[model samples]
Target chain A: MTETGEPEIDLLSHYARSLGIEVSGFEDGVPVLCVSGIDAIEGRPGHFHGGATSGLMETAAYALLRLALHERGEQAQLKPINITVQFLAAAKKEPLFAKARITKLGRRSANVTVEAWQEERDRPRASAVMNVMIARSEPEAT
Target chain B: MEKEAPHRDPANVFDPEKAAPFLFAGGHPGWLGLTYLGHGEDWTEIRLPWREELMGDDVRRVIASGPIFSMLDMGGGIAIWTRARRFVPIATLDMRVDYQRPAGERADVIARCECYRTTRSAAFVRGIAHDGDPDDPVATMAAVYMTIGDFNPAGAKND
Candidate 1:
């Protein structure tokens, strides 16, 4: 647990790491992900690809779900059920930031919302809502 | 300073198959390793092969949902272009993906997208992602794309 008593997880070793995404610490008790826009992720000329932006937001949601599970002391497999993404603005070639919040957490599923921003948090380039299915781990034999 | 917009020939028919190499060569699509499978009048298919580095959960060996989203988005966009028969500047406004099941650990995922409807400014698309079998899809997706500029097939530039 960190200063806020939230369980810490090493996200850098995940798939986002392949795209140069890194954990930038926590904000308001939520993990934030950051990624630098490079030529590999560019779409049209000077703009960031919509797919990359969506990927960043989804990764944030996954991290949030993982943190939630850890906080609840539940060991289960998390699987994505669905995800909806809205592109509000054309992402520019700059460092991007993303954070997620759990909207609902039930025994068998979870709902999470995430936002990706370039500069100001108020100005989000893209946002996403995801539903994750939780398959609880079976108790180990005594 | 104001810069000139890229030239576009609206009359040029959009051939997604022929343009696949250039479109997926150096960007996110390229990074995801999207390959052109085939295309029809208003539909296109693309594939994403499995790779260890693309796994979201290392222990589970499951691929991340992000790359799959990228693949479907590209597939959907290509479907729209094929339906419109012209390359126009368009932006994805909103997209929703439903994962029916986790993709097979060692199987390549394929997405087939169809542009079902289009208006002056918006195109509606739907698709399915499957691993070797269309009947058993890994995910389903619905999306909308909005045309940014005038649809001047003759004057639109292909970038």
Candidate 2:
């Protein structure tokens, strides 16, 4: 585990890989994921697509949950139950950042909140709340 | 306050079928392989075909929720245009998505979004995503979108 108590998370999903998301570093001691808004993720002429923004938020939330589980010495898989995303501003074609925090972690589920921003962290472009189910039995590796 | 007109002028009617390709092609939606399926007066349907790179859990062959959210977002946007009868500049204010179940392996997901209500400044949308059967939805969504610019459908003329 790193100094921030986050486990080494390797994004294995194609969705995250396709977006070219990476663990750039930590912000304010919290782990942050970064992605560049390329033409593939653009919506309007010069704006980032809302869907892609949500994808980044959800992926960030999953990474946080994975770290929390690792810290607790629990082996579990996360299944998304719900996500509520709120768009605050138009995201321009630039680098985007996302971070997540676990609000509540129960035996059967976890609630996480995530935010995405560009240029500045204080002025977030979007935020989302996600509830994910925690399953103990590990599935067969693909 | 006076009630706004429910329908935009016929001259400015927005045809979702004709606009889907232009709006989605070469963008995020196209990258995800989203395609226009069908539409109604106030509703639009779109499809997201299954792809290996989209898997959330490769073991279970389950696709990630991100693509599903993207599909719904696009569907919701198109539904708003269908209802407003014009392509008004808009932005998503909030969207709440509830996942009922993981999509089946190798099943293409279809999303149907309906714009049920609209005010002068905002439009309300609801939708469901299903793999094969519409009755057995994989996820449900409720969203709100706010209009931008001088978007007066009643007075605007189509170019």
Candidate 3:
């Protein structure tokens, strides 16, 4: 695991893990998340749950933000301020994928954009814009 | 095109009690342990109990944003059904959630949604999620849903 740039600790939350979300690697130095259509995240029988997709997208956003924090060698706690999700398509029972990037990274906050897709990357099943507040584990330097 | 399955006749009144079991049985709502609490003419209230497994920030002891977001989405759907009284089929077109604070430690979340307006092909909704007090909410949501009498499970341009 150390050989690769992936973090040694798990980036996903317990709920995400229960839904079968995983860190599938990275895209241009950003972490990507993937999940199989399990019963836990099932929606309308044959489709993925809307909330499950939102969760995966949020996890990806956090993953991207966490990496940035790691790069700065800073330990911080994240507080979600807002998330706006746009449902683009109904997902089927298959491997769902998501990735996020930092649109703006400030000293105490970040804005991220994440997209969830299945099969075709061009066509996203859902996309979200997220704003997170960072509470530093240690006080910022004067 | 997929064949249409037999569905309940469209009515003007919705009963959350009757729909609870079917809606929360085996889907993501089931996994989240969602329950129907009560409803009004155009609104629905649902609950999500506390579970260690659903915590977002382990240290803060707060429920993740995803679960709260999920709850609001489902609550909004039920509200639409309650208002429209026609549970034909609905999809979340867009939702914007603003977090005022995180859920209290080990506190169950209560969400209430209202379908304020409905057109021929869409519904607009608003809701709030709180741990104990409705006055002080953990989050608030504004959403839009596309209502279609004939639902297709395959996919839609805006699902």
Candidate 4:
């Protein structure tokens, strides 16, 4: 188990690793993760696959949630309840970046908002809202 | 019957039956081993078989929502082409997926999506992800896509 200095994420997660997501760094206490546009993730020629965009956003949100949980000393396993995403623009061949923050951490659940961009952070390629149920037990590999 | 189908020719109109292998044969969908189930005039179905790599919740042993999300997106896009009867590049403007229950519990998650409406540049889709019964769906999906350039058969895709 990692401490609370940085967002403690399981780097060995198959799905997250499969997407090639890596922690770039932190900004304003939030972790900004990134994934490259490799051939394994291409969609419709030059555009990012809708699902790939969603996955990145969702993974970023969970990383934030994990950080929040660790700060509270809560070993909660997260289960996604819903996710709504808006694709503002078509994502191109640039490296995709995403960051998220906890909107609300209730007793039984938590809400997170995430944004993804390619180059300019201000011009987000997509944004997402995710809600997950918190299982207050030993956190599993997400 | 699966591998014997002819290669997809870009010149023809869309047919999910013929295009399934081509679309899902590689890239993200193929990497996940998503299967093409069947299709109607306005809808298409695809399945995600269980794999250890697909596990999202290691404790609950559930397939991650991300793969399911991809399955829905692919199925929804194909449904639109099935309705349009032609291939056209489209962008996902927005999509919302609601998990009514948990799926991929050492089983399979199948997505059935229908393109119910299409304007000049936008298409709307709705569908469900279920283990076996559509009535008892694990998740529901709603999405809209904006077609690039002219949406006719002879038009070109914008990027």
Residue B76 in model 1: shift from native, Å? Answer: 0.8
- In CAPRI terms, model 4 is classed as medium
Per-model fnat list: 0.85, 0.93, 0.86, 0.69
True-structure Cα RMSD, model 2: 5.7
Question: Candidate 1, which CAPRI tier?
Answer: medium
State the local distance difference test value for candidate 1. Answer: 0.84
In model 4, residue pairs whose N, Cα or C atoms come closer than 3 Å (at least 3 residues apart or on different chains), thus clashing, are none
Best by DockQ: 3
Please state the error at residue B4 of candidate 3 in Å. Answer: 12
The alpha-carbon deviation from the true structure for residue A27 of candidate 4, after best TM-score superposition, in angstroms, is 1.8
Estimate TM-scores for all models.
0.91, 0.90, 0.91, 0.89
**Worst 10-residue lDDT window, candidate 1 chain B:** B1-10
In angstroms, how far off is B70's CA in candidate 3? 0.4
**lDDT by residue for model 2 over A16-132, one digit each (tens)?**
888777777765545698889687778766888899899989988887777678767778888999999999999998999999998999989999999999998899999999999
Q: Per-residue lDDT tens digits of candidate 1, residues B1-159?
A: 011221234555778877787777777888888899999999999999888777878676766778888899999988988888877788999999999988887678999999998877889999999998999999999999999964444454432
Tell me the spans in candidate 4 whose CA falls farther than 4 Å from its real position.
Answer: A1-12, A138-142, B1-11, B152-159
